[model samples]
Target: MRKKTTIEILLFSLIICMVLSAVEGSVPILPLDQVKAGMKGKGRSVFQGNRIEEFDVEIIGVLKNVEPKKSIILARLKGGILEEAGVISGMSGSPVYVDGKLIGAVAYSLGTFVKEPIAGITPIGEMMSISEKRKKGPVFSPQVPVKKHLTLDELFMLNKDFFLSKAVFHSEGRALKPLSIPLVFSGFSSYAFEQSRSFFSNLGFNP
Candidate 1:
């Protein structure tokens, strides 16, 4: 059966009101270890004009150890505004559910300029760890809180120093990096964005 109900919730951000919604009620989360390829699912996110909408997701497979203990799940998306916009950048962290069971968050895109709506999902297990860390404190990794109003470039520079300091003494003798943070650039044209990429990259950002 297809679900057609829409629930809207207002999310107030720094500069705008973003409306996000999901189906009401509790949904059991599917464990990462039990997720398999070919399973069908549904994901929810804001697609057009701040309206929350639903989309389809079909699991392709799980890529293990993509970065240390971390893993990524590949899934092809369909339906809703995805047919028009493809996998959008702002849709990151959209909740994905399989058989009414929560599976993961839409975290990455295959690339720009793709005809297909393929996305990389961050497993619920890994996402939960991030939430747990946040609960323990606002300061992730270094236990030091940064002051407000720092730009994206400034944050990257601070994080680079934090990672280097940890690399010096990790018991495994390897660097322990933090989870990736989303970087959003608004109101920039292709030429301007390209020109500014190097400026951000030099500050230890991937751009």
Candidate 2:
């Protein structure tokens, strides 16, 4: 009886360790160095009505030094309505996993009306580094002076830095820009919304 009880305790301990290790490995990060071209992965995001959906990702290649000490993973995304809609504006920062390990997030999109849902992924390592920096200190402060009346061009010029950045790539006279975010307006008249639509679009918001 003593021997049997000892054996049972050992088995229980082994099972507990296995469970813990499995939990730890479930969301492991795949390092950028190990990532290669032609890797296939799946990304999760909400396409409609808060329902999380999965999409397929195929790695094209890695863009080295896209920014100083940063890299972007180029990939072609498919599945769901991606082929019809292309990369949706708000799909940025969706986690992409390759070989059951996270590689990066969808952050940049190919030019408008592209034939495919090609995207640029900001690597997990780079994102983690940015998060670490944010924890160190305050990284941004908004101090823009608001003017009561300004023309569309003047408004754009005032926020030019916020509206534009260095393009990720240029193809066929189109620059890879950040995916525009969709904005919903409530309690506004149709005329007001229409009037401001172009202004918001220039600032990367699709109203």
- The candidate that wins on TM-score is 2
Q: Which stretches of model 1 miss by more than 4 angstroms?
A: 1-27, 137-207
Q: What TM-score fits each model? A: 0.59, 0.64
User: 49-92, model 2: which lDDT tens digit per residue?
Assistant: 99999999999888888666778888899999898988878996
Leading candidate by lDDT: 2
Candidate 1 whole-model C-alpha lDDT, 0 to 1:
0.58
Per-model root-mean-square deviation over C-alphas? 12.2, 17.1
Ten-residue segment with the worst summed lDDT in candidate 1?
A: 1-10
How displaced is residue 183 in candidate 1, in Å?
Answer: 8.4
In TM-score terms, candidate 2 sits at 0.64
